[model samples]
Target: MTALSDAEFVVRTVADTACANEEYFGQLDAVVGDGDFGYSLARGFEHVLAQWDDFDRTDAGVFLQKVAQAISQRVGGTSGPIWGTAFLRAGGKLKGHETIAPADVVVALRAAVEGIQARGQAQLGEKTLLDSLVPAIDTFEAETAAGASTDDALAAMAVTARTTADATKELQAMRGRASYTGERSIGSVDAGATAVAVMLEKLAGAWPQR
Candidate 1:
């Protein structure tokens, strides 16, 4: 597929995934943090989808850049900064590429993880999205290195992302408002991580057909 088509697929998948899990994320947030995460994510992706026509007219890098700006403007809370930074960094990694290769996907994942880390200043095991995304990226890279196809690599990454996200329930919160809850944060998955898992799963599912 063309870069523009791939990006469009990603955007649509993200929006749909977010909408499907909005209530679950909201419930997760209500436990140990502010309960607006679901709404914020939904709003951000909605804005992204609304601008799909405009993004389709641009290159992959510019398309992602526009998406970042749109999400940053439309979404509230840390979700805006975290997701915006992910897209912006991924865009930078894809700059000047007419078509994205499987290796390019790995590079973009690394850039996204770095961007989120830089923006949130949160480390792995912090009960944040990094807990999921970091593992997912690692799995993607490892699978790719083993000569797996893009579809297989992404599938492995999605499974790891979901597993890691679920595992976060056993960890204590070390950042965000959830940290304030101390031991109470345990037994509940991080909302951000859950959302990331959902997004990655959707991306992997869409990759094969695309």
Candidate 2:
């Protein structure tokens, strides 16, 4: 598939998955936050889906820029900017590409993770989204470097994302409002990390193997 089609499928899949899991995310947030993370993410993606026709699908970079804009503008919360910046950074790396390959995917994920780290000043084991994303990227990179297929690499990444996200349940929140919970946060899975896992899992399922 062309990069544009692939981008469309990815955006649509994430939007659908986020919207479907909105309430659950909110519940997780309620355990440690204002309980609106799911709502904001769902609304942001819903806006993206609504404006799908306006995106310049022919250009992957343009498509993602528009998506980042929509999310940053419409989504109400810190998550909006963090996620938007991730997409923006990843998109920027594909500026001249008409089609993206598995290597491009790895580069994009790496860029996105760097963007998040820069924007949030956070890292793994802090009970943030990075907990899911970092491990996923590591697994994907290792698998791909070992000559795995795109499908196999993505499957490994998804597994790492799931495992790491679940492991957040054992960590005391060290970032965001969840951190305010102190020891109380130890037993709950991080809402943001859960979103990361969901996004990765959905991407693994939706991405086409050329």
Candidate 3:
């Protein structure tokens, strides 16, 4: 598929998966938060799906920028700005590219990670999604650099995402609502981290079908 089509497929899958797992995500968040993460994510992604066809499709970057607007405007709470920033930064990284290469994905993601860090004022090992996401991105980039196929790189990413997400249990919350819980948040996983892992796993699983 063309890069635009691939981007579309990934965005669609991400929205659909988030919407589908709302309750599960909420439960994860409820462990240490007010359980709003899932609702925020699902609502934002639902807007993306609801207006999917109306989005500008000039290129992957433009499409993602449009979706970022939807997510920023529609999603409630802190999640809106954080996730919207991620999408917006990625879009900015890919701006003006008619067709993207594998390396482009890494560049865009690196931008997204930076955006999330800036917007959320968080970093790796903060018991946030970054804890899992950063490592997963690193693994993907390393695998691709080592001459692995996209599929293999993505599969490794999924594995890293899952393990690192679960590993958040060993971390103390230093960001987000979970931070308010102090030591109480140590045992539970971060909902955002798990959600990232689940999304990557779902993407890896559906990639072959695509």
The TM-scores of all predictions, comma-separated, are 0.95, 0.94, 0.98
lDDT of 2 by residue, 1-210 (tens): 788777778888888999999999999999987899999999999999898888876588778888999989888878888989988998888777888887887898789999998888898789998998888888988898899987888888989989999999999988888888899999999998888788878888767552
Question: Best candidate per TM-score, number?
Answer: 3
lDDT of each: 0.88, 0.86, 0.92
The top-ranked prediction according to lDDT is 3
Badly placed stretches (over 4 Å) of model 1 are none
List the candidate 2 regions with Cα displacement exceeding 4 Å. 208-210
lDDT of 3 by residue, 75-165 (tens): 9988999999999999988877878777999999999999999999998888999998999999999999999988888899999999999
Off by over 4 Å in 3: none
Error of 2 at 50 (Å): 0.6
Error of 3 at 113 (Å): 0.7
Which tens-of-lDDT digit does each residue in 53-170 have in candidate 1? Answer: 7764468887888889989999988889999999999988887788988788779878988898898999999999999988998898899888998889889999999999999999
Backbone clash pairs for candidate 2 read: none
lDDT of 2: 0.86
